[model samples]
Target: MNKAKKMLFSYSFLAPSIILTAVLGLYPIAWAMRYMFYDYKGYGQEKFIGFDNFRQIAEDGLFWDSVKTTFIYAGGKVLVSLPLALLLAVVLNRGLRGRNVLRAIYFMPTIISSAVMAVVFFTIFNSYNGILNQFLMKYHLISKSIDWLGPDHALFTVIIVAVWGAVGNYMLLFLAGLQNIPDDIYESASLDGAGKVQQFWYITIPMLGPVLQIIIMLAIINALKGYESIMVMTGGGPVGKTEVMYLYVYKLFFPTAADAGGAVQQIGYGSAVGFVTALIVGAVTMVYFFFSRRMSRTF
Candidate 1:
């Protein structure tokens, strides 16, 4: 076979995946971009309105609220989960008995579906007759059952659930990174009178920089893109207190009406919200990358 025919055969093999990606991924992105320039409803007619949708989005208070909520949710999840994961990884790396079993137990949550987890948490966080409240009451932690899904407590509940769902994955990441560090380094540090803290600070942390960077990046992206859990747990409800950007976008597209009660038929505005969200996520990711790179250099 000649070079051209070989190339053709290679291209033929690649065609299906390329075509599928274009159809599923690229097509919607392009369609969303196109719709962003228009006053397109969920269906029927679409009228081009230039930057009107963008302007409205800019002026929308709800959009800004969602943005704030998204940042808070993302920041809280990352801050809480990463350190906890690292700590757990370090503990597990100490070669304790049943460490593998404990790691599996921790990681099991990550493999479970987010929706399923949401349902489980939903039951756990039930304001009345909930296990958490019952435990609190039994232990004298609280005199009465607290409303976990109330307006004030809703976001906090979601954050706790988010952390629980996320920690296992990052723990596994850190565990793998921990294993990759040379045992000789730790032994040398120990010989030099370096304590556990010193060994971790001077050796382990430095070696884990690359893995830490990747984990942090993924955590930030996951936090920013969070939707399913919030949707299933709170439905972005209790007066939109837990309404992150994704759920806000979902609601914009499928607003509850007087008759339908919970209907979202505004695809264009949702697309516009999605576009804005993409921009925010991209900017945040860039900032994270910049800081991570700088930190890596420092180490």
Candidate 2:
């Protein structure tokens, strides 16, 4: 076959996906950008008010509060989930009894639907007659059941659930990184009389640096864009204590009147919120890449 024909065949295979992405992904972003400069309600007229949406977003206190909540939720998830995942990965990577079964058990949470898991957690955290409270009371930990989903505790509840659902996936990633390490490296370390703790700190961690960087970046992005669990569990409720950026954007374009109970959509404002959020996420990801250094050493 001619070189031209070979290149054409390879290019043709990617054409459909390229076109689909442009249409579905790029087009919407372009559309939103255009409308973000205007006052575009769910329907009817769209008034072009330059930078007003952006200004409104900046001046909005609730929006700022949501941003803070998002960071807290995201930070908490990374802090709790990643370390737990690393621990589980290290344990499971060992030649333990029923390793496969334990791995499946650990990973089961990731496969469960987030919405469904939120509902289950909601039931489990109910202040009155919930399993968690009941167990705590049984052990005499508290004289009364504490409200887990109330305003005071709502954010922590969401964070705990997010950590539980995320740990398995992160653990699997760590396991894959761990498996890539050569057995000879560890055998040599053992010959040098290196203790297990020394091996983990001096060898395993340094070797897993590249993978750790990827996991941290992903965890940050996922935490910032979080919506599903907060939606299903809290609905940004208990006076919006658990509200995050995406949930705030969702409420903006899809609000139901508090008392009159009519749909009130603000597409323009929602677009602005989303655009700002994208900017923040993009900046964070870029910063992570810029500052991250190589930790792996050549054996």
Tens digits of lDDT, candidate 2, 175-234: 999999999999999999999999999999989988898898899899889889989888
Candidate 1: TM-score? Answer: 0.96
Flag regions of model 2 displaced more than 4 Å.
Answer: 258-262, 294-299
How many residue pairs clash in each candidate at the backbone level?
Answer: 3, 0
Pairs with steric clashes in candidate 2: none
What are the lDDT figures for the candidates, one per model? Answer: 0.89, 0.89
Quote the lDDT for 66 in model 2: 90
Task: Provide the TM-score for each candidate, comma-separated.
Answer: 0.96, 0.94
lDDT of 1 by residue, 8-42 (tens): 99999999999999999999899988898878777
**Candidate 1, run of 10 with poorest lDDT:** 257-266
For candidate 2, the TM-score is: 0.94
- Segments of candidate 1 deviating more than 4 angstroms: 258-264
